[model samples]
Target chain A: MKNIFTGRDIVSDKGYITKRNIIEKSLQLFSVKGYYNTSISDILAATNLTKGGLYGHFASKADIWQAVYDEAVCIWRERVFSGVRDRTDPMIRITKFIENDLRNYLGADVFEGGCFFLNMLVELSGQSDPMSKQILRGFVRISKLIQAWLDQAADQGLLKPGLNHKEIANFIVISLNGAAALYTSTRDDTIVDQTIEQLGFYVRQLKA
Target chain B: MKNIFTGRDIVSDKGYITKRNIIEKSLQLFSVKGYYNTSISDILAATNLTKGGLYGHFASKADIWQAVYDEAVCIWRERVFSGVRDRTDPMIRITKFIENDLRNYLGADVFEGGCFFLNMLVELSGQSDPMSKQILRGFVRISKLIQAWLDQAADQGLLKPGLNHKEIANFIVISLNGAAALYTSTRDDTIVDQTIEQLGFYVRQLKA
Candidate 1:
């Protein structure tokens, strides 16, 4: 899992811990302050690391950003699929995924800014760069995951045979992203509660 | 209405035109590049204005952001409400508002990024600042507008008497913001087309 990272020559335990610490601090900064909004100084301030000390671990701000972003995605994946990843039932897995997304991913409060990926998706989508393309690919991947679940459900004779899986998957993605953006800003519970309930109903209605 | 803006002491036509020109140029930069990503240098490069010339028109980058953002909202409001703003039929107004939102507002391609407000909503909502509050307030205002239309439909005997207007309005806002975010990045027409059709069906299903 590459949980341990260090300079090539410095494989000391302290160096590995320092590198991980830098990533953890920078994740909070990037999640809330955003990519461009977060300055190198912010990371330094948050991590209490000098430029030399910080650079000893990462090459530059971009290097730290990549490390932080990767870690955030790891946390998000673990949270969103904690209990349901190993489930046997496709329908129950789908339900648990949505529940984990609402109560665990967006509701985890791990990052100060709520869902790190969605915030990045929103911010990066505005810019034209490889990162923007990366964010879109991430959305497509999640959509595909949901579609696979729906297909499995259909195979299990639970979902309708003629329903469009891609459309439904995209719709679910939109709803979850909307709920995160709206709930994070408004701090309104109904946004999350209603979305969870409505989406459950939407998926259940697709049953054969 | 505020097509013309002038400095307190300089009401010259050249100053008025230059200020408007700056606003127009900055709007494009902020729309696609985002609030924090767009630097004063980018704005200057786009406008070909000296630092002095740019500062003469607006007090600071924050001032320029406010001007640029306000102009974007003005354009958005006009685009979303152009045909049905004064329409007498509440149901038709609701339908047209959704249509305009999908085809006219999000689909207008007025801003380089897509929906200016939605992008800002996603970006600024990540940062805890006055701008975030303003963005949430803007969402609420839109929700209230939709709720008013729903209420009007109910008053006119066109909608169910006991439907929850606030939830529906909030759901519509979430859907539109989601649609704009998804469509802008993916450039997928189905995001908008499906939203328009789904929302229309959703509203129609509320009949008395």
Candidate 2:
């Protein structure tokens, strides 16, 4: 296909492409060395870009950090939410969602660090930054998704009568985060395995 | 009161006192800025120690990290485990243990970066350093404690009849770690409230 756009148009397209590249690379570095530890120089080095090139796309180091956070949220929503969207059975859908999540997390090119949410949560919790607000919005979004999933499960009779969807949703979110924390810290799949098993047991208990 | 040993003994006591101060200050800095982000100069600035004086105690930056980890583990054991040592009722003891844990973790001074276990877990998980090994050991030790508590509770008919102690223990640990992760990220007490509520619900299920 012949491209009609040229010059400034191509430059804008390349700008988006370069920004994505920088964000992905920054995510890996930040996950490994953490946000505070990863400097602008580190991001530049990873992207093999000059300071002028980097700043042309991002106003500051904080701007790039926000971009990375946004990309991570996008990937998580697509990978975890989209994977479970088609299933009619709540129990199966939930199980598949957990399975896909573990697979994506573990089947990585590098074990840089843990979940972006958990990493950002710990790193930015006490610091007041633009990125902190983004992290909070991401967390609230995940919790709400879990709540919605549980509510659907209960409505569909996949959950036992009188089960508390809100409580169970909170438990699922907390336990999954915990499992991710443990897995990232230990780099052991067993923690993930145990979490999966325990989650399965909890879900099975919801059956009438 | 007159000390029994003078001169050398007093000097030794002073040495111990200074070392404790170094470790305490190092913990705060590392917890705040993390391991790689913290430099020897940062420690010196925080403690007002000259290079020679710091070298007199810790051999390197890694040595200081190890000391911080050890001190954190020591305090964690004393605060969380000591309360559960003598209780015969597993359910009651576990509940008390969780409550004590929440209190310690949610305290204003200690609540900044969440639990040290979690901080190190994310910070040190992929590294091949001795400190990483120590971090792993601490994780195993904490998980085993939960396992033991669950086993005891199950034996005494304190847990739901069909529950597996190992699985439940894993769930409890994961949930606790997850709560810490959330609290660390959000720096909000709502996560702690959710954790306490979840633990209470689980405990009730365990009780006959």
Candidate 3:
């Protein structure tokens, strides 16, 4: 066997088009019905792809799930990091990052399905899925990203001197995640606005 | 044709005993596997009950879902209210309520599944499901409870005289939910501890 189906080429190839379609449809279905609620048949119905077609790319439902999660996390990291990267001020960059997230997640129909990582947090809290571990690792990665941003801001004298960086970082991340949860639950724009305002207040408080 | 199925009677009866058992088991399953992932057969296997026995109380799988949700919400309300009712000082009561909730949710293996409302919120964000509506209503009820506590605390000179009660209440409720999200995702005790600390700090800021 050639085993030509091994890496990025697998996803980049035309033959793997079904795999990409499966991931896209899976993201939509999983976002709507959730990871557990969405069946293989549901995916098949959405994509009009046969089981063999799906199985050809992924080993099992869990394999497809891991792919969907990886893709979602990749998108979130790129969007969030790129959104705030150009700003010189740490506070402004943080705010912009949050605003960008809100706009993407709550602004339009783009994320009317809610944040994928947050959803996984709820759906896989106690479940022993490899995907669950991946989700937690994603949170740590994101939290570290936020912490790094805050550290830069502090180093530049943008944030209050003596502010506990790790604590504040955790606070910001948890608050943002909480805000996302509230927005998802209410499907109300007000929650997102309140979150924005709260973040603003916290940012101001960070100034000397 | 007696229509003798009173909610209480059915909940307490023998034949309906298995029905309730099935619902409880289904809740665990659904919470873990999600609504679509767990089938009737899965429920049967979990509860060791036959189809006829399962259908004795619930007319269908949807009925079982509704019953499980109702039961979960009822228990959550009791837990929240019980925590709130014990303290006279609104601020202290609110703190205690959150503390109790954190203790209960984080301590127990069962609630480690995350907030049922939070879970459903993500699962049904843009969809029209009776369970979704019910979850939203539950959030409203919780927000109202927080508002009432804030009002009472203000009256008792526990809160700042001119604080926006509704907004504060909203922030608190949303933050608490967010905290629940963080805890559920990370399964870290520190998240809950940090939430309590931040909440306590916020409450102190509200003191008259």
Candidate 4:
């Protein structure tokens, strides 16, 4: 992990940290004020970077936004995905995946602003841009990951007969995003608990 | 219904229509670009109104936003709520509410961008402002409405024994917002269908 707070950076980590600093600062703003509301000047003021300094690292505001999004995905993997990535049991992995996102990833450590991908997804929807397409790809990737686990669960005979893993995965993804949408705005932990409980109920019902 | 397209204002409806025009245009921009991203200039250009003319109706951008949100609530009543408002049966009312929101409201006619309340809630979360509080009130209103229906269902022995209407309402609210988050971004009707199907399943399980 790049140390974004250190005033002085080591020779090897300086450039990387500087870039990380810009991305982190811009992300905080973008997640809060949103992409269009956030300006280059806002990022510069937040990061204490000159126009030339910021531009040297990022060509434009859009460039910085892309980096922020990439970093957000990395944060998801490190904070949420990494926990479930190595689990051998598909059911456990799926359960852990949902658990981590609801209990931790959507919590303050990962983002007080809530799920970054979902935020960007809704914010950038209907836009005809590379960024928009890229966001869509991110959702597709996450959906595929969930669906793969669900398929494996079926193969292992862990699911109820005739159950559709694809639709189940869709339900998990949709409901989780919905829970985030509510919890993110409400900052109400009970909402998270309720959503998780319901999800757990669904998973248990799929037991053979 | 106020005629939004007419250039010549009917005498009694002149002031009402002018305010409606500003609200309508601002709602469109706020729906697409969000509240903070939208500027007064953007609204002016969209409405073809001079600054003074616009200010005559609203004092500031925030004022316009408040109006936009109010208009959004009104739209909700007309398009989604009105269908379920008069129904005395709790189960049928809840079903109609969800169906109208998913099938009609979240569809293109009501908001090509998506649910205005959800958008604002997510966009305005964690902010220290009147707008944020207003948005919170909107969510509370919806949640209470859903909860009331669930409570009625429970009282009438239309629900599963030991069922908790509070949690169920929370689940419904969270999941519906989730569906909107996905459907808004994907523009896929199938996602809506899947969410509705799952919700219907939940409703069916509540039967005694």
Per-candidate TM-score, chain A: 0.90, 0.86, 0.87, 0.89
Chain B alone vs. reference chain B, TM-score for every model: 0.91, 0.88, 0.86, 0.89
After superposing candidate 4 on the true structure, give the runs of residues whose Cα lies further than 4 Å from its correct spot. A1-12, B1-12, B82-89
What DockQ does each candidate score versus the true complex, computed on alpha carbons? 0.48, 0.60, 0.49, 0.63
List, residue by residue over B57-132, the lDDT tens digit for candidate 1: 7888888878877888798888888888789988888889888988887776888877777777777874636887
Best by DockQ: 4
**TM-score of candidate 3 chain A against the true chain A:** 0.87
Those runs of model 2 whose alpha carbons end farther than 4 Å from true positions after fitting are A1-9, A88-96, A105-111, A152-167, A204-208, B1-8, B106-111, B153-164, B203-208
For model 3, what is the error of residue A30's alpha carbon versus the real structure, in angstroms, after optimal superposition?
1.9
- For residues A10-35, write the lDDT of model 2, one tens digit per residue: 66777778988998999888887777
Candidates' C-alpha lDDT: 0.80, 0.74, 0.73, 0.80
Every model's TM-score: 0.86, 0.86, 0.82, 0.90
How much is B200 displaced in model 4, in angstroms?
1.3
lDDT measured at residue A23 in model 4 versus the true structure, 0 to 100: 92
- Expressed as tens digits, the lDDT of each residue in A1-208 for candidate 3 is 2336564564357556777889988987777667767789999998888888778788888888888987887777666666578787877888887777766654443543677777777777676556677877777776687788889887887776776666666767777777776676666787777777666655666676
Best-to-worst order by DockQ is 4, 2, 3, 1
CAPRI grade of model 2? medium
- Alpha carbon lDDT at A195, candidate 3: 70
Q: Compose the digit string of candidate 4's lDDT tens values, residues B1-208.
A: 5456774556647777788899998888888777777788899999899999889888999888878888888887777776687888899999888888888788654775777877777777766457777876776778788888888888888877887677778788888888887787777888878877778766776778
Q: Please provide, for model 3 over B65-150, each residue's C-alpha lDDT reduced to its tens digit, 9 standing for 90 to 100.
A: 88888888777766656756867777777888777676665434355366666666666666655667787787777778888988
